[model samples]
Target: MQAQQFEKLSLLVDDQLDKPQSVQLLKSVRHDPALQAKLQRYALISQALKGEQAAVADLDFADKVKQQLKSEPVYLMQRKKSDDQFKKTSLAVAASLLLAVVGFYAGKMHNQVQTLAQATTTAAAEQSPAEQMNAQFKEYLQAHDNVWYVNNNAGVKSYARLASYQSR
Candidate 1:
């Protein structure tokens, strides 16, 4: 048979031919024994391909997968109780150590400030009024000299620091 005749037979087997085209192909097929044999061959090939798909689907693939999953060991993911307890204990100990260090520094500073205040009071009592005023003025001048660097700096923050110490 010619290639065009084989192609028309394939299109007919696939249901791709329109009604008029199918009628024309059928008319040609009626007169040709070779075309009838070709149609039977195409139908056999199509049925074989479809049968393979149906055969595979009928083999119970889903049921086999379920059986495999049921045979596997179940696993649990979680930390042990002892590890959680240890983490909480370590965190508490670290917080207590931090508080203790902070308390020690605060108490030490408080004691030093009290001692300095007592020393200043005792020194002021020993000096006469005129000597005390002169001593106070000298201390004030020394304090001002300590922050003299602020006078040359330029910024709102620098002026703020200077203003806080200006009167005292």
Candidate 2:
């Protein structure tokens, strides 16, 4: 009548209960028609599982299923092939974009450095002869300071003559 009695009935059909419990459950099943019917169903299920009864399958069911599978279209396989190709193309495009970006920045930085070098060369070239000579004289004075004091008045006259020559 209760769920516990039904479970005891199943265990009894499987011969899983101990001797005393089996004896008690068997006595209950002897008096209960619903329990007897349940016991019969359990026995039928056990016989079907053991391949003693053909509860569901016909003889050609496996062959029919194999034939159906063989006749089915391979749409999933075709889609996987397309997906692989798309992944490869997407990776190639991403690599190309990365390379293009690196090359673009490299070219831009090279141009900036080249422009700076050119500006420095042009600035040096545009200096007047007097300014060039003055820079050279200052460098010489720094290197030989004892000579600067020895030829102080002569150095002033020579610098004046150099400036006049540049004007000419």
Candidate 3:
């Protein structure tokens, strides 16, 4: 699935299989001439590339590898210290960016809350009961501006007139 995985599989194919297992695999496919030809072609290619086929013919590869290991040992040293340092730096940078985003949103939310509080206080100050009643009365008077009051000798009476009254 990954280049690393493919490389590991290739290493297994080239280096890990026992000679008997390799022979068994080759023999299993020997009936298929095309498969045998392909194996021979790859063997030749490997021989040509490595210049070690003659040595392979004389020696058991797995035993030779084990003998070489007994003679000259190998150890893997840890080298991820610098890589780990870089990872920590990357994590710190990401954390700073995340904090900046949160701070920006918090600042924006704080400003919005302040503005809302100011607006509510302003609205409350402007909405006294007396002021509301006066506004309603003024609206009613303006809507009925064409009406008139008449006082007759018999009784107080009301009349309608087309004259309009305006208020500021």
Candidate 4:
């Protein structure tokens, strides 16, 4: 195959051909062994540039390399740039999602701490056992008038039993 035809075949394999060029190259190179060989070498070079492993062949090595250097496309360079930008965008979105989850948990913990502080402040004002006992004794004393003057032992015993029952 002519070097120029081989270059066009490379463009077709790389999907850089438009409709007219692609149809022309496809019909011309479909049964041409030399053009197929050039396309295979071009594919190998593309794979090597992309950090993929491919088997290298031994035919017309220097000529194929020179042709590849002359025929490299503008779009391949742009494809690499777009791929890098996409990766960066994906990483940024993942970082934002992680930060949102952490912020939500931090806000929940802060609200829980505030609720516990309010409960602690409320727990300080409840009535004590001694204050409750004093109030009950005062009420009992006000309701009875004859207990202070009673001197009979049997009456005192009966009155003590009545007082115990009334306290309950």
- Regarding lDDT, does 2 or 3 come out ahead? 2
Residue-by-residue lDDT tens digits, candidate 3, 1-168 = 344433433443467766775665656555555554444555556667787653323224667888888998667887656888899999999999999999999999999999999998898678989987866776676687622321123343434344568899
Of the candidates numbered 1 and 2, which has the greater TM-score value? 1
Q: Rate the local accuracy (lDDT) of all candidates.
A: 0.79, 0.80, 0.64, 0.75
TM-score rank order: 1, 3, 2, 4
Clash tally, candidates in order? 0, 0, 0, 0
The TM-score between candidate 1 and the true structure equals 0.34
RMSD of candidate 4 to true structure, Å: 20.3
Cα TM-score per model: 0.34, 0.31, 0.33, 0.30
Query: TM-score of predicted model 2?
Result: 0.31
Which candidate ranks first by TM-score, i.e. highest?
A: 1
TM-score, candidate number 3 = 0.33
In the order shown, the candidates' Cα RMSDs to the true structure are 17.8, 17.6, 15.9, 20.3
Candidate 4: Cα lDDT at 99: 100
Weakest ten-residue segment in model 2 by summed lDDT: 159-168
Identify the runs in model 2 with alpha carbons over 4 angstroms from their true place: 1-79, 82-84, 130-168
Cα deviation at 85, candidate 1, in Å, is 2.9
- lDDT string for model 2 (1-168, tens) is 589987887787778889999998889887887877777788778787778854555445777999999999876544336688889999999999999999999999999999999998998899999988987887787687645444565535444356743353
Per-residue alpha-carbon lDDT of model 1 for 1-168, expressed as tens digits?
489989988999888988998999999988887887787778778778777432223234667899999999998989568987889999999999999999999999999999999999998798899998876776786688734443434333554456654464
Candidate 1: give the clashing pairs: none
Off by more than 4 A, model 1: 1-79, 136-168
